[model samples]
Target: MLSFLEGHTSEVCACAWSPAGSILASGSGDSMARIWTIADVMSRSSLQNEHSSVVVLKHVKGKTNEKNKDVTTLDWNKFCSAPPASYPSGMGCASCGHVKFKAGSARHGVFRVEGRLLATGSYDGQARIWSTNGKLKSILNKHKGPIFSLKWSKKGDYILTGSVYKTAIVWDVKAEEWKQQFEFHSGPILDVDWRNNVSFATSSSDNMIYVCKFGESHPIKTFSGHQKVVLLFLFSFSSGKKGDMWVSAKHYFVWAKLTVSNGTPTGSLLASCSDDITAKIWSMKQDKYVHDLREHAKEIYTIRWSPTGPGTNNPNKQLLLASASFDTTVKLWDVDQGRLICSLNGHRGPVYSVAFGPNGEYLVSGSLDKSMHIWSLKECKIVKTYPGSGGIFEVCWNKEGNKIAASFADNTVCVLDFRM
Candidate 1:
């Protein structure tokens, strides 16, 4: 919907929703990555608001009413390189203004924990880091093929990059080099997830998932049961809930991202979407489905568990699940009972992404319909609509739920400043 934010020259490839505060990152084939934030950069509503995030970085140390600062510094070239000479003096960060970097065809982009930094992978067989002000910080040019996926370590100390070369790399963000390199997949690596600050898992087109760690040359564990490429895998952690962490891998079953309850002491509750047009809640310990939610008529694409939980953020509240599907619908489920508490339908095409606000009071969805919807979960109604220039590939709420970011098929990313 936000057209004023335009810089890419080709179709956007991937987008990352900041687990931190109000920040967003998008990668495009135009060989560029863009970072976005709201105009009120100093707003700290995200603190103590994103469930129980342990990696959130502190705000910039300066104190002179940083609110109303432009989301990003001006005069930084679209290439994320040094500003051109024709620009007026003092147009950009004096120090980073002279840094040299040329953004390649971006394949993926993600923001680090505090929203102060970003990492983007490109078709140029490289990855680049940028500061929150959109200044280029570092460039990693090591992979052999276009990097397709990336995952930052929980503490923001490491970054894992997956590529089409049947290989993956773990880069030390501070040391600025490959901490370790891994190669075991028979085909291209499609997805990756960090299970802890030091270990992670990778799903490959070869139909396998590998558990690897830093400084290790071989996989510590491997899973091989999928009949087709394992296209999706997600790692989730909740410090407020027994300090538990888990990873889910999606296979030919038409995988869906799974979310764990924030802080349930008994056991972790996971919700998964499937191509069978159903949402199921499973017990991590029992390894069995506990409840089944059937309402959608088409394959479900995404699912997210509310950050609030039974014993944590909102002890008195029910744990909720949000599921989006190809049927152009988003459904909210009551986890304990597996009941379809509410069905939200407003998109004209397949719903590709759905996310719960940090407060668990709102939900946002994006779709091939070229629009984004912000729904009030408590009201079961679409409260707001944002127009778009192309079909949306993804939509996500920042940690505080104060900003929503959507990636477009038209090679652009739009960040909406949400007020509710």
Candidate 2:
């Protein structure tokens, strides 16, 4: 068993690792985010001492009372101290007002591109950037409402920010400002991610996924196949220049991509996860359904292909697809053969977040139970569970896949040293 790492007063919202996997960065609802080094966490006594003065955890009845408590104390030089634009991790109001500046609530979520930087969306209606070493980078204060989600492009050059204010903005990270990338739906943007280069996709409370492209002012392709609001999405890759990929979801629907070669839409494929407790694949080219997978009794929330293994080189790899659901289990499927390989069960609460480790031998999941479970893929059993301060919202492993960083709903961040 490993000793747990702790330091955050409120719900921990976001966490990321430095490129070299030396330092971990986290954002929380306590109105502050922090960066911790590997050495800081490895030595339990050292980590506790350095983080002791950073957070003052008090069980308050109201969520908005965080500012009234000692958790608002910023760690001067040791923590986020940069001004609003400089990307300090501390919770400080950066809004400008003629009467009074509302700092808004603390952060709710965070995401990172690589080692050097990461992005966070806060209830204060802002998105801020930070260095993995715990330095503040920049602050964006344009969203009229709280930012719900933040995603970085694969290139790390740009980021997409979704807000409850009913709009999504693409930011040019290099320019240190907002870019007029595209306007999202009138509803609050729930999730967003880039698709390769030419296009990006966004989901909203309206239960729609808008496919957007560069230069266009509006969504070029509006995909409206899901009955419920889409929560998560990912794009599969193809090495061939002319081939296409697909995307899946919480409700029923898979989106297939078709490229134009001679000014013609060549192919299409689609997949759907329905309330009927079934998942199906579609042929976009034929505009019809192709196959159905009725493996689980509940809704599917997560689906991802194995970047390595059979999904890449071996034709046999194409048969593997990992899916997690409200059923409290994770099912590994042979997509090509359309059958189950294994069903992983351990978590007591809804498995809200899941990710495959770099080695593919371990799988990590965060749950509403306020804990993160690390499982051995080969053993198909829980190896360890790290308790957190609040409802565990997300868990992200550093580059080396040894240390895990987690975000909580109470505005706090927890760093776990697996080796411990």
Q: What C-alpha root-mean-square deviation, in Å, does candidate 2 show against the real structure?
A: 10.9
- Compared with the true structure, what per-residue lDDT tens digits does model 2 show for residues 1-420? 232346665556556565544566556666666665555344443434343223222223366644322211111112121233444333332221102122452432222223445566666666776544444577766778777667666545666777766787877766878876456676777666656445666666676667677678877666555565565554444212233434445422222223434433322223334344444443323332344566787777666444343223322223245566778777776544567788888877766667666555677888777778888766778888777646776676665777776666765555666652
lDDT of candidate 1 at residue 89, scale 0 to 100: 35
Which residue pairs in candidate 1 have backbone atoms (N, alpha carbon, C) closer than 3 angstroms, thus clashing? 1-387, 31-104, 31-105
Question: Least lDDT summed over 10 consecutive residues: which range in candidate 1?
Answer: 68-77
Q: Any idea what lDDT model 2 has?
A: 0.55
* Best-performing candidate as measured by TM-score: 2
| TM-score, prediction 2 | 0.70
Where does candidate 1 stray beyond 4 Å? 1-3, 15-23, 40-113, 215-229, 238-296, 310-316, 333-342
lDDT of 1 at 413: 65
- lDDT measured at residue 342 in model 2 versus the true structure, 0 to 100: 86
* Candidate 2: regions farther than 4 A off: 1-3, 40-114, 133-135, 184-186, 238-242, 251-294, 299-305, 309-320, 335-339, 384-390, 408-414
